[model samples]
Target: MPYTRPARPPPEEASLQGSELAHEIVDVLVDRQAEDVVLLDMTSLSVFADYFVIATVDNPRQARAVVDAVEAHVLADGRSRPKVEGAADSSWILVDLGEGIFVHVFTEDSRAFYNLEGLWNRAQEVVRVQ
Candidate 1:
């Protein structure tokens, strides 16, 4: 199948109600056994997203699992499904949780090459799951 972007929420849905949602996302990543899971507070750093949940997985299969887990939790939380990218290759899947969160599930090498955390050094690291 060709790469398809997940449905994006309306623009007005930018501000998530509770602050704990990001942590909930972190929990999902941890539960999926994602490695080096890091939640970065990007509110002050970027208007693009309030939080960036970056996770490193061992391979493409693990990446897909992490993405599925995240989408499930976000949906159960009453949030719109995110506009996802990179799922076809499953090397680096980005789950954009419309307002409050943006998740990045990357293969180990891809994560290192992108160095997302390094680029957003201004954002504070809120959660780190082994």
Candidate 2:
């Protein structure tokens, strides 16, 4: 069967469970042993997404596992599937979950270089899973 992407709901029509969904994502990452998981509330800071989840893994294999686990959990929980970008081997991988959720997986060096935390410092830090 041909696959179809879910249409992004309007802001007013956005899922009310965005925060819960974000927590669910964090849970998945923690279960997968992701390091330094950070959740940022971007509701006021950005128009592109409402929440950003960042996590670091030591190697490409761990990165891949974290990505896969997150994807599986989101899908199984009845949320819209994200459009994944970048390969597992890449230093960074982004998963865009429409209706204001984005997941970023990066290597330690890549995380430092990009410094998403610093860039989004204005966004309130909701959770930091160490």
Candidate 3:
């Protein structure tokens, strides 16, 4: 499929600054068997963040597990706890590790609705974890 550009650049480059931390979070998700892991590079666009790490879990249980793994890993790495949002319903969870790594954990329906991959068409795709 063709790529699509985000409506606006990320609010800051903070997300891109902590890429290693982001990668660690991705690794944790993968380890937990998260599905459809994807990394979006938003460096070229005018935005606040530099990168977006998106992934999917099969269900609410997995969604929560993914977030837990991310939190634990980031903390273990000695980074500040990420500012997380959207966990109440567990359909879509956003973990903000200020600088340039924004993580999104979404359910199938939510993932389809947000279509982040489609929205960030212009951003470079770093990887797609099957």
Candidates ranked by TM-score: 2, 1, 3
Clash number for each model: 0, 0, 18
**What's the CA error at residue 54 for candidate 1, in Å?**
0.6
Q: Which digits, one per residue and each the tens of the lDDT, describe model 3 over residues 14-122?
A: 4444566667677888999988898877778746777788988888878888888888887887777889897556799998876567889999899999998888898
Q: Candidate 2 lDDT, tens digit per residue, 1-130?
A: 9999778666555645788888889989989999999999999878788999999999888988899988898788776687899886888999887758999999999999999999999999999989
Q: Candidate 1: where are CA atoms >4 Å away?
A: 1-18
Give the runs in model 2 whose Cα sits over 4 Å from its true position: 1-15
| TM-score for each model | 0.83, 0.87, 0.82
- Model 3 scores worst on lDDT over the 10 consecutive residues at 8-17
Q: Stretches of candidate 3 above 4 Å error?
A: 1-17
TM-score of 3: 0.82
Please give the distance, in angstroms, between residue 44's alpha carbon in candidate 2 and its true position after superposition.
Answer: 0.7
Leading candidate by lDDT = 2
Candidate 1: lDDT over CA atoms?
A: 0.82
The lDDT values for all models are 0.82, 0.88, 0.80
